[model samples]
Target: MTDPVLPDLWLDWCAVTGTPVDRRDEATLGRFVLQAAPSRKLLNTLRLAPLATAPAWPPALRGDATALSQLVHGGTSRINDPDVHWITRLRLRRLVFAAVLLAPANQGGLGLSRIQARGLTPGRLQSLRPVIGRTADEASCPACAVWSWLDVIGTNNDWSQDALRALGHHRDPAGGEVHRHERDDPSHGWLDWPDHPNLLPAIDQWGYLDRYGSLHPSSLSSLVHAIETLADARIAPARPASVEPVSAPPRITAEEEAAILARADELNARVARILKEYS
Candidate 1:
């Protein structure tokens, strides 16, 4: 999954999938990748780039377990339980945001949000299950805990009333409940985001969910960096050094070349036969 291996991985994927390497169609290629069925290997290749960088996949595919773990660490940790954690304010918001954003309804997420979310879910919480790395509160059921926290946050944010109410509560019939740390403070306004369904660009632009949203790249980088730094802490950064230059695509082995040639010849022959039948 390192940078140096990406070229090989891409070449192998294309060969296995019978796709050609076409740099001119990177946008198309990127979309092709997103629409394809999920593969762990495919997932790793996409992570070679920063989530906010050019050629980025949509946020649905990007919220892998590692990213989810980092986003919801406090909730997963017994020692860093939201009740005692110093950064609980920010951590809890990020957890709720990630839950709503990443949990794909069509997937096993039970329609946690109206968005086309993917990745984290109650069943999948087993992946982020806390180890005894810390000692404060006993590790609880992450799935139930997540819903409880969502109910608390949504209630605090008043998501049950007015505009946000139309979107529905984060906790519904499908969601289970657990005891959550009590919070009497005012809402921090994490969802004060733009109306865009895909908040990835908005997050990339405004640098975090806030009242102000702007597209001017320079003004947003610092803010984006700060939030992304926290969220992407566990994510392996892209390695620019190992990336092959644009002109030099990965070299296929002689065996691979022959296989591709043979496949090409087979297709050509099939076409000729069909043409002859028409003729």
Candidate 2:
């Protein structure tokens, strides 16, 4: 089914991912970009979705027309040997948060209100400096700083693992993954300061954090773009999601799938040029 009416609050998945629409299946609804994921937690008041949030995964990956829900999960969702530089890490971390907002199912919210409640730049870093590590008593650590921001949005940073993986960064040198190992050492949860979990101590493992102070990336700007988009959705409420059904039934046979893709390629055949436009 297509969302005939644009959702009151939806994110442009293709725009954020810089990816263009290639599939034109009956299952889709939005005009150019599709609504892929659902986000109702923390920021439930706002309607936010990624550009590709509603479309199916690239058909190349689902030749058999496998279920997308089964595909999106069960994979590690993490990239291997990622850089540990603070700037790279921070951008990746922010994207991880954004990824959760784009999750396809059983999604949760970040409880993110402070940025909207308070201006994005005001008192944020200072309010954050106090408890950015494993606990309030520890020294300021960038990794923990991420957690503190999450703590503002949700219960703890543990919620970030799925987000991190979905966003494609599993090699967290700062080691936010420590929460996964907590069952083995219950006291790991009790540690109140200084030490957060990591494959190696972030101090010794990541040299970039100490080398750089406040350098930012285009990602931060892109994030601001997303925030502005969501903030506007809250104020204006956009259009209601269309519930009308597509002419095609829920299931399509293999021959039917082939015909659909062929029609799509014939209709939107620019390929490289189109990807460049969207990319």
Q: What is the lDDT of residue 266 in candidate 1?
A: 53
Best by lDDT: 1
Candidate 2 per-residue lDDT, tens place, 169-239, comes to 33323345453212232121333112222111111122122111121323233433432322222222212
TM-score of each: 0.25, 0.23
Compared with the true structure, what per-residue lDDT tens digits does model 1 show for residues 120-184?
A: 23223322222101112223333433444443333324333343332222222222232232223
Model 2 lDDT on a 0 to 1 scale: 0.28
Worst 10 residues of 1 by lDDT: 126-135
Residue-level lDDT for 176 in candidate 2: 53
Best by TM-score: 1
What value of lDDT does candidate 1 attain over all alpha carbons? 0.33
